[model samples]
Target: MTRYYRALRLQMQPCGISNHAAAWVTTSRLRLTLPTSTSTPPRLQACRNSRSISSIALNRTNPPESASTRSKDGRQQQNGTCAIRPANREFSTPSKVGRIYDPKMAKLWADTPMSLISETGYKERSDIPPGHFAITAAQNMAHLHNVIIRGFNASYNQCLAVKPDTVDASDFLFYNQGLYKSIKSHHDVEEDITFPSLVKLTGVQDIMDKNIQEHKDFDHGLELFRTFVFETDPKSYDGKKLQEIMDIMFPILHTHLVGEIGTLLDLAKYDSKKLEEWWADTSKKARGDLDVFQDAPLMLGCIDSTFRLDGDPRPFPPIPAPIKYLSKYVLEWRYSGRWRFNPCDTFGKPRPLAFPNPGGSKL
Candidate 1:
């Protein structure tokens, strides 16, 4: 019985469907042998589901077509991958181009728009010294410094003229910021280019070096003033604070201007070749450190005359005022053709004019 049951189980194992429909035997009497491939015909195994059966038949008969479809689907999936998307890629080209094309200058002169102040004739030319180019550069530096100084003085006076309590804090801050920005920018250009070049040209490295140091000192004072204006309470206009700010600022400015003027006058004697060489060397060293020179006006208006009014009465008369007045009058007379002879010339020995005080104050 056991042997018969084992044989029945072997017969039921998945082999195939037979063509004969009535080849059955009772389980108690059955005996079966597995068919060898050479002796048995090929058969179809039964699938559990219709879809799986269809897929199996299709795969067997059309392998190349199915493989082609799979390859196409794979390619689309790869293309849709987030890592391959356009938006995911970094924009490196613009930055690279920018670095390549951008001008590496501290200031550009051409970008500064210039307007003609007058259409009249220029001032008379003077004989330049051997190192005239260096001297000219120094003069330009001095002129620019004076221009900024005058601008600061004017701005400060304007601020002072207004009643502090009535003035808008925002307006005052804005004004101070503008003045500071302008002055600081100008000074930076000088320290980075103008003064350094002048030093090289004149070969007065020591003086130039000292000037650079002075710039640091000047900046220190400026920082303090900036802090006082911006960081401190706007309503705090105590006498001590005001005095402190003035005390730190005025002396530094006065000394800087005086020293710069002296240096400029000394530089005026250098030759063109020396100046050119100095410029070349300094420019090479500076590389793109300097900003592009914007042709902004050195000054907006004339300097204040009030600073000169601060001293004791002198024994000698003030010479510059009369000279300035006479010079203008003489030029006007010449232009108008109202003079009979050369008003500038004299027949007697030229003696200094005794300028009598019109106001009878006993001196």
Candidate 2:
């Protein structure tokens, strides 16, 4: 049967004409036989003259009276409406509803004016201590925290649209590694270098203990993130599952950063030397431990988890107090060349801090 079919196909081919011309002849024959009552004679003539065999074949395959052609004609039948077919196989039409603005809502905030609060009322009255170096260090650490947080938030939110499974495996690995290194190094520096140096500079040993405990809390959150990355399939991330992980970790991170900032502020008030020592140690650790490649993965994991509330999309909460402090601190460190010491005067304009005063002012 196959042999007979092949012979019949060979016999169907034109004797001297090429396959292209044969196809044109076959299509033209088909076009001549199509019913002419439905379409205008001009369209039929135009189809006959179109040189491309494929065009004629298409016209014959989707005859003018077919459902699809009728649908297209129906759309054209509508006055002043353009039928747009998308590449994704969806059809769309222009909206007729005009934009409506709520005047009451618009007017509510329109009459209210904004003004910068005066710095005069909020100045710290403490005398500048002789060991200016320590004061600067505390300020620098504050800055570093700010930068890291901002980088984390920006990178994380950018990746939300990325399917967890679809994320580059290399990037995921890098992000996790960077996160571990950054957290571990920060903890190590506080325990071994920053805390000890602060003790020597300020003669206050209790502060060091408190800082160590804070580091331990942060380490707990880091441990949770590490476990999630290792256990969860990146590609199959369930929003709820990711959110559960985030809920457990963000508060810990927030608390740890806020505690550190509060401690630094206290140090700044008393012994600037200790603050300077702490900043130097932390910077040294951060530079050595943080891996840029790993940041993205860590951030993705963190954000995916944090933003997963009730498995529904919601506005990301305001930047945590610790992150804000860290951002400001890092910005200062970048702008000012001093890695170990940042003078209070350099914190020129009063800015928001995680720690708010009784009167609602940021410390």
Which regions in candidate 1 have their CA more than 4 angstroms from the true location? 1-131, 161-167, 199-205, 232-243, 273-363
- What shift in Å separates residue 38 of candidate 1 from its native position after superposition? 99
Please, what are the lDDT tens digits per residue for candidate 2 over residues 279-355? Answer: 54443332232211232122221221111112222212122322323223322223221111110111111111111
- Report, for every candidate in turn, its global Cα lDDT versus the true structure: 0.35, 0.35
**C-alpha RMSD values across all candidates:** 42.1, 26.4
TM-score of model 1 vs. true structure: 0.39
Q: Work out the TM-score per prediction.
A: 0.39, 0.41
The deviation in Å at residue 55 for candidate 2 is: 30
